[model samples]
Target: MIAAFLLLLQAVAPPGVATQVAPAAPSAAMPTASVPLPPQDWSGLPILPIRRSATIQANTSMYVHGEVMAGRCAKAVRTAQGWTLTLDLAVLATPQGRFRRVTPRAIDCPTVEQYAAGVLVGTPRDAIDLDDTQTDTWYRTSMTFTWAGS
Candidate 1:
């Protein structure tokens, strides 16, 4: 079931985009028995889907397009054909799949980092499947965004 879910997520992701997941540091106070075992293959987790929001999409599109058109990211080799940005996010959620926070690791481009964080923040709480056995733990996930040159 997890395999299927991951495949479905990859199928829906745009070209050049990828997702990976990892367990965050466990709290020292938390009982070992209570802490769920982390998945061996962290990269196999499904990518969280962004919520349907025209405003967010439009804003992201405009920002990325503007940056590409202006050649703001052209210096990077990844921008030769276009621009590619990878964002690493630390996500905290409840067992019920409610998102508590989505924090992005800083990148060279502050604006892009901010946008990536916003995208995660805009994702639906239940987008990620959290079983009853899950606890309130942080998960590390990465998302890559690519845009073709005009």
Candidate 2:
């Protein structure tokens, strides 16, 4: 399943774009269980039917599109997990439009996943084909978050 998921990511990713999975770290107080992702189905394909450029732009906008948080740092930041997180997402077609679903290839922190999902879940730039004959064409996307240190 892991191999299939990686291959799907490679097959659908845009040119020059790379897919990375964040590594997990051990913690004295962290839980041993893992977060669950949506089950794989025909809708699990990585590439979306929408224009790739537009989708890319929208996804990128999620990071720097909000208010600036300058010079307020030097504050103590701590987590039971690693500071960086990488997540695999699938944009699926829905009656309302597009829905973002996380296919948790690697998730070390539930908080990080929740934060990312809140920022990410939304309709795609273009509508996906809803035809019954469609192969459930899905888009594969990844997001990585890295702290200033560690």
Q: Compare the candidates by TM-score and give the number of the best one.
A: 1
Task: Name model 2 segments beyond 4 Å from true.
Answer: 1-44, 48-84, 100-103, 122-136
On a 0 to 100 scale, what is the lDDT of residue 84 in model 1? 62
Q: Rate the local accuracy (lDDT) of all candidates.
A: 0.52, 0.41
Count of clashing residue pairs in every prediction: 0, 2
Per-residue lDDT tens digits for candidate 1, residues 29-146, read 8543333443445455444444343234545555655654665544223557766656676665566665555556655654555556556654544355555645565666766666
Report lDDT (Cα) of residue 128, candidate 1.
Answer: 57
Residue 116 Cα positional deviation in candidate 2, in Å, after optimal superposition: 1.6
In model 2, the Cα lDDT at residue 108 comes to 48
Number of backbone clashes in candidate 2: 2
